[model samples]
Each structure stands twice: as structure tokens, then as C-alpha cells.
Target: MNVAASGTALKRLRRSARLIVLAPGPRVLMFRYDIPGRDPFWVTAGGECEPGESFEQAARRELFEETGITAEPGEQIARTTPEFVTPEGEPVRADERYFIVRVDSPDIDTSRQTDLEQAWMNEHRWFALDELDDWHEALYPETLRSLIEEHTA
Candidate 1:
């Protein structure tokens, strides 16, 4: 879990996939971090909002932790609620906010977390946003599929 502001009350937050690296192959690159104590097995790169900070700031921090890339937040994309099952077979919902940001960095540094190790996963398994098998399963709204589809296409 990455901190939003590097302070106390670094509380747990609902998650969203802050998408960067929108490329030409109808592809949207996402960095998925592995957070312990969860089912569906992974969490996207995002965190709780910071005090007096925009959502963009928290997005950037999460991006840095998961991928080591820094980006300026761009247009708001989608809202989704990713569904997951707890280890004990209970259902939980996480509200997710999706956004577009162009990242520029030598490498994505996964150095921000001491608690969880970051891992990269493909957003769409069969193809870029095509196969429904490997879904992002957002915690917010579900418009990102279309937003990213339009952005890439």
C-alpha cells in the first residue's frame, strides 16, 4: 500500500487503475500491484486522496509505486467498481476512478511500498481490450472500457 501524502492516517483507499502508456496497438498499459490480504489477487495503481491534494496527486503516487513512472494527470476517463472476493469468501467492492496520463520516465520504480510488492499485469489477456477473459475489473464505474477503446482506436 502506497501513501497518498506520506503521513499518518495513511488509510486504506478504494482503488482505480490510473492508465498510462496509451499506445497505437489499441493498447492501454496498466501497472497492477499485488496487495496482500485480498482476493481477485491484485489491486490497481492508486490510493486514498491526500489532504488538500487533487486526485491527480494520489494517482501519480500510486503510479510511481506500481510502475516507477511519473505522469501528469490528463482527462478523466471512467468510473468502475471492481468486484472481488475476500479470502474468506466474502464479497467486497472498491470504487475505482480511471484517468489518462502520459508518463515520461526512464523506468517505473516499484520502490514506494514496503508492505506490498508491485507486479505488472496485462489489462486484456486475449488482446488489447478485446478478450473479456482477462478483465481489469475496476472498483469504480465501467466507462473505462469505452474511454480506453476510443482513446486507442
Candidate 2:
């Protein structure tokens, strides 16, 4: 394990593939993560890539695993630059790539979520593009509105 300057044990670098799922209303689906000791935040469907899995493969798998929806992950859209710690308390430098996926229905099934996901992800909501600005909870990537506008336009 690598040690950071702050004496924190750094886990291996991880590659994450995220999906921005959009429905007929042009709304985006977000999961509310209520991790311990942290305020709730909403994020897209995604997770770390399994061994030897490509970003696209991981995106597809995560989409199914998290939402129970099987759809092809569309084009790459955005990426996050910061190194963040996972909810499991592991410090990781994650190469997070975002993709777009358009679906006909906004319904989601969380029955396939892993134990860790079920524990922390307590709620989910589909937000209209215009409502995101007024949303009280934090949304990851900070640039979500612009990213959606760019893609929709």
C-alpha cells in the first residue's frame, strides 16, 4: 500500500465508470448517498471497474447492478479530477469517467445493489434539468447542469 504525505494509507488506483441516465422528460436519475459522518449527496450510477474490465464494460455492469436497467452506456461526457475517499474509508485516486445513457422510462430497480450500496444509498430521485439549481442537497461533479445542457443541446 502506498502512503500519502499525511501518513494515510493509499489504496491502489481505481478506475470508475459513471453513467448519466436520462429519461423521456430529459430528467436525470440520481442516487442519494447518506454515508456516515457526511451530509447526503446525489450522484449518478457508477462504480469501480473490475479486474481487466474496460471503462465501458464497467459502466454497463454498474448500470445494471445499480439500477437494474440494461442499456448501452452512451458517449463519454465528463470526468472528475479530485482524489476522494470511498465510503468504505479507503483513500483512492480514482480515474472517473462519465458516460450518457438515454432510457424510455424513468423507473429504477435497486434490488440488485450490493450490500454496501444498499446501506448508504437510501434514496433516489429523478430531477428535471431546470430543478437542479434549486436542489438543496449537494450534487457531485459540481458541473452537472452544464454537462447536461451541453449534451442536450
Candidate 3:
């Protein structure tokens, strides 16, 4: 556990890798998480890195686990600075690295999601770049729209 300058105990740092999965429509795939006690929010497909795993390795593994899409996680494109609690109730300061993966098809397979994921992640969708701005739900990273626009430009 880390400590803040104010002498408060801070959430443990969790290293994570995320992917921006772009489909044929130049749309991005996102999962809607309905975590208990919190409003639903959309997020990319990714997860925490296992011990000794590189960000790239974790990104690939998470992509398969979350969407069943196997692809190379190319150059990192964005990152997030936030402190949030996981569904399991663990508070964490996430060091999240983002990468881009382009898929030929938008088909997703949730068969591989863990029990926790299945319970919280009830829906998935591919949104066009412009659709993100008008999206009613909150998007993690907050800067996702601008990030996508910057990269896809």
C-alpha cells in the first residue's frame, strides 16, 4: 500500500493493459459494466497484468479473455490516471496502458469472461467515432473520444 502526501493510505497500484479494438466501420468496441453500487460505465477490453507479464503480453491475454479476439496489441496510444475500486471491492490506483488492435470483424465472444465479468459486464457494442460524444453513459479514461480521434485521424 502506498501513502499520499497527506499521510493517508492510498490504494495499491495495479498495472493494467487496455486495448482500443477498432472494427471495419472504424468503430471502437466497448463493454458496459454494471458494477453494483455504481452507475454503468463503458470501458475497453483489458485487465490487470499478471506477475512477470509485460504490458503487451497482458493486453493480448486480456483481449482474448474479454472478447476472444486474438491480435497483436500494437504501439501504445493512451493512458489513464485514476484511482478507482474494482468490482471485487478492492481500491486501486490503476496504471493503465492502452494499445490499438484492428479487427476485420466486430464479432465478440464473451464465453471466456470470468464469473465476475459475466455478472457485471452485461452488454457490448461497437460505436462509431462520432457516436462516443453523444453517448449517454460514462466512458472510462474520460479522454477516450479525443484519443480515438487523434489516433484515427
Candidate 4:
């Protein structure tokens, strides 16, 4: 590992803001990414927080950037600290926070997705909260079900 000019190692922590967008049918927005020869996984809409941006600001920006949907950020429902390696093979510890937003429509536009996001985005769908259990245990937050129930109930 190389040290920085200040004699500090490079930071590996990434702060992200995500949203759980709910629609009129009480369904939540989710997206699936599948690669050939690998299991499919789902994720909510959001991305890394930009410099000089607050978590809420990042959530709003990413919600639009990733899904072309816009809504007011509600309660912060969950937070997690997880470490993983990026596609570029660099280790990253993610400080991810999730917020809830209810919307009237589910329409999405893909024109805004960054090249990196477009690479992994396969399809998007709206899922009924009751059916979330059938998706198994592969959701990004893993604790999503409980988080939803906590805030909505």
C-alpha cells in the first residue's frame, strides 16, 4: 500500500445514500442485475455520496440519476457498514444509509445512468412488500424487510 503525501494510507471508506421508493400499490422499487453463470441479485436505487454533499442530497441525486424518479426523502430507515472489493479490485468499506420515499408513479428513465451503472443494471421492477420474502436472502441490505416494517408500521 502506498502512503499519501501526508503519510496516511489511502482511505477505503465509501459513504453512500440509498432510497426505498414506494408506489401507490404499496410496492417498493427494486432492480435486478444478473450476469451469465452467476446468481442474480437485487438492489435499491442510490449511489455514492459526492464530495460536499449531505447524505440526503446524495439520496435525492442518486434516486434521479439511477432511476429517473424523484421524491422527498423520508425517514432514514437503516444504516450499515460493510466492506467489499470493487470491480476494479480495490477494497472499500461502505457506510450506506437508506431512506424511505413514497411516490405515486413508478416510471423510470435510464438515460441518466452512468456508464458504470449501465454496465450492471439489467432490469427494474416494482415488488409488493408481501412478496419480498420469495426473493430469498440476496437483497443488498439483507435487513430490508425489517427496515420497511419498522418504518411503515
Candidate 5:
């Protein structure tokens, strides 16, 4: 478990679970996000863990909540704890865990998004591995590409 909090002073810890959801085309799912003055970027789908929820459970719930996609969240492939200010300027400490799930192509459903997600997510795309190399500066969990390669290898 990891803890993350954002603010000038870090006090609160938020644990989150993320998914590296992949389709048959070997493409990875990502959300386009824009943070005010910052350039747009991409992120894997996920959200904070609810109280008393295990990481795996949170991963499953987050996937469904964010994309209306359902699948058994497989093994945890990576974990990181990072602290940053949210786009809303709230300081947050995030304990992020990444899980891998593979599925056939499916249409995404976003009607279930939380308000925060509705505001932050601008669009969604399935990215080819080579495309990721060009998106390094715009990818969250910056080590995402290497992590995927490492685990898949």
C-alpha cells in the first residue's frame, strides 16, 4: 500500500489503484487530460481506493466507473507513491498501484464517471506501443512505457 497527498504541507494520504487495460490490437487505453496552463497529457484509468477496500478491489471498481468496462484485474505489475497538487490545486499524496488486464475491443462507456473524472478526462484513445515513445512528456506515471515493457517481457 502507498500513500499520496497534495498540498503545500502533505498530511493526507490517498491510496489509488490503476489499470493498464489492453485490447487485442496490443494497444493500451489512455485518457487525454488537460490541466489549465499545462499541455495535455495521458493517463491510465483509475481512482482512489474507498475506505476498507483492497487495491485489487479498487482497480476493478475504478475500471468500471471510468470506462464502463468490466474484467478481472490481474496481477499488480507496479506500485508508486507520489505527491502532487491536483489540477484543482488541492495537494494530494497518491499511493498508486498498477494492474494489467487484457480484453477484446469494446466500446467505452463514460456515463458512470464521477464529477472529477468528467471534468478531467477530455478524450480517450487506444495507443500503440510505439506511439508511447512520442508521448513521454505527456504521460502520467512517467515510467508507464518502461513498466509495460518490463512486465510484458
Candidate 6:
């Protein structure tokens, strides 16, 4: 086992950003990896804080690039981090901050997906808030889960 990384402190650069969608309704933008031999698992939309851009700007940029959806919601934002492992076995981490942006139109302009093997998500649907619990429990970070729970409660 690698012993040094365990004792090595993760000099966390707390990124102040946002997770775009929280509550369910019209359309919650999520992504799934189009692996060669497995079903897809949808995920929330978010990105890291840009050089000097605010979380909102990054969210909008990411949403458009990812789902081709342009959302302009009017709600307060939250910050947190979620854990993930890369397909290559390396660990991936992101300090995410999110806000609820109620979309203006129903038809999102998607097409930015470019990965030949990891692109082409089969489905995109708007689900109820209750539907989020399972995935959130499994995928979302503690801070994100707690924030969602408090809001739902």
C-alpha cells in the first residue's frame, strides 16, 4: 500500500463553485459516460471555478457546453465537493458550488459532446426531487447531500 499519500495532507484548494441543478422538475441536466459495455449513470452538471470567473459564469458555460442548455435561474447558491474515480483508476476531486437556475425554454441545444467512446448519452429526463436521493446518496459529496436534504426538508 502507498503509505505516504495517506499521511500527506491534501492541500485542498477550496474551489467556490456551484452545482446547477438540485430540485427536480422540468429538466435537470445530467451526464452519463457512454462506456463500451455498461449502462449509463446520469450525473449533475457543474465545473471548477475559472481563472477569475464567478461560480455562476462557470455554471452557465459548463451547462451550455455539456447539455447545450442555457439556464437563468433566480436562486441562492451553495458550495461543496464530490468524489469520483477516473476510468484509469486515478482519483478525481472537484470542489463544486451550485445554484438553481430555472431554464427559460424547454428545448436545450445539445451537441457539444465530443468524446467518441464517452459521448452520446442515451437519455435525458426531468425527474421528481425524490428520485434524486438514491443517486445523491451514492454519488454526491456529504456537503451537497446535506444541502439538498435541508432544502427538501
Clashing pairs in 3: none
What TM-score does prediction 2 earn?
A: 0.91
By lDDT, the candidates rank as 3, 2, 5, 4, 6, 1
**What are the per-residue Cα lDDT tens digits for candidate 4 across 29-66?**
88786645556788888878999898999998998888
TM-score of each: 0.54, 0.91, 0.93, 0.84, 0.87, 0.61
Q: Which ten residues in a row have the lowest lDDT in candidate 2?
A: 74-83
Where does candidate 4 have its weakest 10-residue lDDT segment? 84-93
lDDT of 1 by residue, 45-143 (tens): 565455665666767776666566666667666666656553334454655666776533334455665343423232212125563235654422234
lDDT for position 75 in model 1: 66
| Pairs of colliding residues, candidate 6 | 17-97, 18-97, 18-98, 19-97, 19-98, 73-101, 73-102
Error of 1 at 29 (Å): 3.0
lDDT of 3: 0.90
lDDT of 5 at 147: 84
> Evaluated with lDDT, which candidate comes out highest?
3
Alpha-carbon RMSD, each predicted model: 8.4, 2.0, 1.5, 3.5, 4.1, 4.9
Model 1 misses residue 126 by how many Å? 11
Supply the TM-score for candidate 4.
0.84
Q: Per-residue lDDT for 62 in model 2? A: 99
TM-score of 3: 0.93
Q: Per-residue error at 10 for model 1, in Å?
A: 20
- After superposition, candidate 1 runs with Cα above 4 Å error: 1-17, 31-43, 81-95, 103-107, 117-127, 132-144
| Candidate 1 residue 135 C-alpha distance from true site, Å | 6.0
Output the lDDT of residue 121, model 3.
94
Q: Which residue runs does candidate 2 get wrong by more than 4 Å? A: 4-11
> How far is 71's C-alpha from truth in model 6 (Å)?
3.8
